[model samples]
Target chain A: MQTLAAGPPPPVTPLVVIAIYLGLLLALALFSAKLFRGTSTDYFVASRSIGPFMLLMSVFGTTMTAFALVGSTGKAFQRGVGTYGLMASSSGLIHAACFFLIGIKLWAFGKRYGYVTQIQFFRDRYESNRLGYLLFPILVGLVIPYLLIGVLGAGKTIAGVTKGMFPETFAATGGSVPSWLTGLVICMVVLAYVFSGGSRAAAWANTFQTLVFMCMGLLAFYLISTKLGGLAKAIEAANGAHLVRTPSELEVASKAGTFTREVGVPSWMFLTYMFIPLSVGMFPHLFQHWLTARSAKSFRLTVIAHPLCIMIVWVPCVLIGLWATAAFAGGIEGTKPAALNKVIGGLPDANVGAVLSLMVKGLIGDPVVVGLVTAGILAAIMSSLDSQFLCLGTIFTNDIVLHRTGKNRFSDKQVVLIARSFVVAIVILTYLISLRGGNVFDLAVWSFSGFASLTPLVFAALYWRGATKMGAYASVVAAMGTWLYFFAQSGWGGEYTVFGGVMPVALSFGAGALAMLLVSALTPKPSQATIDKFFPKF
Target chain B: PQRLIVLLAIALAILHQDFWDSDALVFGFMPIGLFYHACYSLAAVCLWALTIKIAWPRHIEDWAEGG
Candidate 1:
């Protein structure tokens, strides 16, 4: 129920920081335009020329968005330690496992086929333009919701931090930058870079942002932990606050509700969690990365190194969430009852306010360092949002436009222009969606679950010759439909449900795979010539 | 083709859930830690093996061919 502080003067610094970053990003994009004059590949996939550290940075930056920083800490505020242990830790390890086993194979195939998008792989494997036709739309549909979550979260965070200082930083407008205007301007700058340079600019910017975010995050953690009496005192405070121990079955059921008697994670949801990694191949941004890897070796190395990056970035987030949970046990706003009543009629909208207060309080020892950490969070959100929207724009142009028109002859400049236009359109749509309000974390997870459901079929197409066009198509539709249906029913409470949790998503994947397997068995296979043409060494 | 691996990971993740949920176990140790380590090790081996099977030979050829 507590309200956030009124915004004004100190905020001008944050606005200045955002403008400088955007200007830099725009310059890079313009530079990328110079490179793009010669080839389409240079624009879209950076001619698959990324180095190891750059590849590592790009992957890291793209995945860890506002979800890992603010949203995660917020979740920790509500759920406690096991949320980190079960959800964050396990999911990361599982994702790493996928990287080792599946991601490497995709990289090899991407290299073999010179695939620009997941659609290319599907089209080749299935020998059906229909799959491409169906999947491009479905992938876009899935991306919209995910993009909504990421973009909205970024917008909201920017609005929160730089509430009334945009005019000062941007210097074009006479008045202060409204929250909406700030979000829109930031999105515009991101689009400018992404549209101009395509993946190359995103890659370089992401690398820079990733390094800065990591260093700042570590610095923030060091300051917070040392100031708050180190890990031992923090642990003692947390445990003393009864925030670290396992919740009772009743407690779990009451909070998670509808999933009773089951401890830890609800049993019914196990399959859903299982299917997510499969969706990796289907994520356009991730697929783009697959295409951008310089060689099979780079692809393999990138995937191998990704988990390490995920681990470092996420551990601090988990610790912060747990610490936030323990430190602010009255539920952030719950601690300030009088303020809550004055603000939102005793509601917990103050959770955001309270957590921010704690964060601000935690940084009392060093304001400059805190400012940098805040900048890092903004960078994380912007980096992920920019890459995702850029990739989504590319798919919209390449998959939907060029394919339907039956025209692959557009000049690189024209394609880039068209793609940038889509980026602008998508930003507007995302802003509208954000205004309607939804939990960014839940939306993000559902979006991932949606895309990931199709990952297994993509793998089959790339590696398994027995997979037919009909089967691959069936798998995609069925998996996507099943995922959409169950995920909607699961609600946004972040609890593992009996049916809708990870278990159902996994089942949907199985169902899709089975459909593909059976359908392929019944159908005529692609010719050996086609197979050799696409996957020669295999 | 990699669908099986995805499924196995999910299933093992479920087993991980079981380990965390339980107080008493068939063995003296916490099954969660045991399963977590076992899966991690097994996955590492598979990764190393796959790398060797496909990548190592290619590396050797590239080394020889480049020379």
Candidate 2:
């Protein structure tokens, strides 16, 4: 019954919240065992029978990951209104477009071929086992780091919110719990739910988690509004504290084509911030959601319903982030002199971190409320991690394993087992990788941008009739190589140059698309008969 | 019709940067809050129409069979 509304608790209170949340997750996992008994279709895609509302929740739940909750807000707090605003506002529109343009066509094709994974779809469409073999491994490689970030974020967030209740043994918090142990534990729990019930469990849990997360967000907004004398006053306070300042540090860094600049960025960068939405349609987990959709209509309806949820869910996060920025910046204004000094002295090095730390500390008023907020953050991370695990696992098992073997075949049971096993493996690998060290936020952007280059090949496969198998393979290789090269160079120079932080990704995607098109035209188009076989006349 | 939807989406995007200003005004059982949300919904609908009409054109079917 620990609620996050009232605030922080005594030293050991985080342990109680951790215990309760883990207990609930485990119970849900065990309960989902019934879903595991069905065939592979039942486990993976739920036999494509999911209704609209459920589908909407599933999509929303899966996408609202650690990045959506914590990373986005933290950036907003540090950088101002520019970083995530455009993305949050446009994500639903992007998703809906994907649905109308691709999801329906994908569903029609997937159902026809009994496609279970991206590789499967590619193989059918391209009519090239060799191409599938090549593409599969690359997808798995990209999926690993992307998947790792989500798992790592889940562990880090849990550790942060619970005040070190479930500490990592090796975590050098200068004496704090090591991130390794925390990551391992969180990863284990995620592995359990996914392994036990497979995709079905993930979908159901996603629905439940979505509700909990949304309610927490709404509650946070309500509390903030009421406590601060409503939205108008809060906005006024924000404005006064200069919290609405734009052209955040990232935008500035992006403009300079370097992360070396420690302060904020040029304001003009925010105006052209389209990569956020572009990345959404290209992200692996998002792509998996499209594949798992039950029907085209369900997909469209789900997208239609998604933005409303975003408006509600994100409002609190944005408000809270902004509120924290203002509250922390002003140094406990209107308070007694001694109290004001105390608040000012306790501030962290970073603005957003200081704000979050302060808010959590202030929660000392109610352990229950503290628990709920902590739960809310953990829920966000877990939702993201679970989906990432499943997506990567499916990519590897279907694309890498099955494709390489040229055994265009697997029983549903075997496929399910392979997928779950990969989930376990990925969780373990990510836990180990996260221990090596890097900023959580940095890892997220890099991981996604790393794969952003592949967008072109995907488009070619879906849209271009001239696309040839060799062309697809060539495009993926060239695009990925170029993108990776830039990513590495940026890291070496201590900044992502070329066109803001997103230039390399954009360029790579364009390069890949160009390569595919040119090669497709030069190489023979797949025979009409082959094309007919893969994409039959409706 | 498609052009109109596209125009509408562009308009909404242009306006998305500005925060909604709601001043309470009474209407039957609907609070000014609900009424405001309804207006927001209209904007959303326009955006939705823009999505289906332009981004996801119906002629996707023509391409579907070819490739």
Candidate 3:
């Protein structure tokens, strides 16, 4: 009697598009895995045969993440346009400098020593295998939270897209897809590609995802602006009301411990935030990606193109977040503009990234296109998660299992299996944590600070041959201590900073470098042979 | 490389000036600060390209490739 409804069953919804996207990802994984050579080398480092273009794609993809897409948008929503200068421009320059200094040198060393992980390089360069114990925990510990950023972003994005899709059973979360299911699904998809295709698959997936996100990001910007009565109108509207109210004569801090709406960003905090991007020079995932290079020349494209890529991806997302302040203020559907404040509440109440989704759904209303663009955002999030998951598995297998246990007993297959199992375990743990929820941008900034503080170690290792192992340990402790000090100063919410605006990284970076330089001077220098090995005559 | 690094550092300095953060929107559209960053990003691409062409240390770059 019903006759199956009307008109091609209304085509496919955004949820179906997402389902197709996931299915394609699995297919890509299985294909890559099938091509896998079944060697531990193949599984972990992709035989170090990746070329320049793919190298560019994978490295950029890994760097962007949900933080680049979701977190940047959200931060921009809270902080205003200064967010671009604070993160993107600084990242553009700092990341390239890092590639030239840290990435190229490490890749050369990795090739020479057949190094598979950062811990492996540190252990040998310092002539202290036990350093692995300290470094491994520190690196993996920092990374797990980074992984949570990706998983949490993915969950938020999916939940945003699927709003009202499950009204009957899932009315709890405004009928949107729940984060737990989204997190679990993302974890499984990333794990499959990583477990199957290994590093090559991750590299391949990253390339594809990066392309998707860039295109979809631009499209989303154009379409959303058009929906908001064009870019000029959108910006003009943003200059109005609570979105961009004229500054008050008196700048007062709110009960939430933040400056009132009228206060602009202080100059000192803006400068200090520059230190955060230096964290890239020390990211463990980046170290692994560097080792996958076919030659140092492969880095040429990455260095040159990376900033441009950052420009393309970041500018749009930042603008979109800023635009959302005005558009969301105007109201969604029949909702009155006057009711906006009560609806979204204050700065802390706004869901910046979620605003992106709501804008897409509201503005476009084309399910298929909305689905594709949402997939693009998801692509950016997952691309990084896969690389991170793979990197964590790698350090565990190479640094901990083989080096620490002194076990040559495991076969190549078993080594890959051990890595795969570790990846699965980490995925499950990250999924569970993501269900509890978090502010993706805030979590990412803290993780970046931790790694940024440790940057002195790598720079010292590469440039200063007299850097003794004891100094290495000292630098880690000092940096970690300062980091924790600042962390506790903020009551562990990663909120506080010195001088009101100066980021914690400013102090921690100084502490790390000073400790390394001073401790190395007092302690015994590394042997001349060791110096020759790493830092020989030009 | 040091000279190139200095040039890159200058690029960062030029872009980081808080002057851009003022209320000067580009053609009544893009924010001036963001517009400056867009230009800065392009300059970065050109600067790095020049660095690779002129300052690449071949010996150091090929150090581990047995070149």
Among these predictions, the greatest DockQ belongs to: 3
Fnat for every candidate: 0.01, 0.03, 0.56
Worst 10 residues of 1 chain A by lDDT: A338-347
Give per-residue CA lDDT, model 3, range B1-61, as digits (tens).
7686677677566567544325557978888767877888787787788888877767765
lDDT of 3 by residue, A1-538 (tens): 0011122222338889889888887787678778788898888889898999999999999998766766667666656676787788878888998998889888888887788888888988888977889888888888888888788777777776766667666879866778888888888888888988899999888888889889988988888777777778777656333222122222223235554442235677777887888898889888889888988889999999999999999998888777755533443332223333332323343344555565566567688878988898889989889999899889888888888666577988999999989888878878877778866545567788999999999999999988989999989999989988887777665445688668988999899999999999999988887887888432
lDDT of 1 by residue, A1-538 (tens): 1223433444355456556666766676567656654466776788878877787787767777766666555554444444444455454555555555555555565555555677776776677887787887777777777766666655555554543345466455323444456566667777777766778888888887788777766776666666556654443443222243244342221212333222233334432454554556566887676567665556455555554555566555545555554433332222222232222112142243234324543334243553566667767877777777877777777778877776557866677677778887887787777667655555666677676677668667756878887788778778877776777667642433443344556666777878888888898889897776545442
How well is each residue in B1-67 modelled by candidate 1, as lDDT tens digits? 3455456555555554534432221233222322343344345345444543444425421331221
Clashing pairs in 3: none
RMSD of each: 6.3, 6.3, 4.7
Kindly report the docking quality category of candidate 2.
incorrect
* Better by lDDT, candidate 3 or 2: 3
> lDDT for every model?
0.59, 0.59, 0.77
| Off by more than 4 A, model 2 | A1-11, A162-177, A239-268, A327-329, A332-354, A363-365, A404-412, A492-503, A533-538, B1-45, B49-67
| Model 2 C-alpha lDDT per residue in residues A1-538, reported as the tens digit of each score | 0112322233556557766877887788668757566676666666766667777777788777755555545554554443334456655555555555556777667665667676677776777777776766676666666666666655555455554333354335522345676677788887888887766677777777788778766765666556556666554454222243323232112222433212232333333343434555556666666656655556656656676777677645655555544443443333222242244223332323333333433523355665666677677777777777877887777677776665547776777777778877877778778788565555455565555567666667777777888788778888878877877777722235465534456667777878888888888787797676655434
DockQ per model, Cα: 0.12, 0.13, 0.53
Alpha-carbon deviation at B28 in model 3, angstroms:
3.7
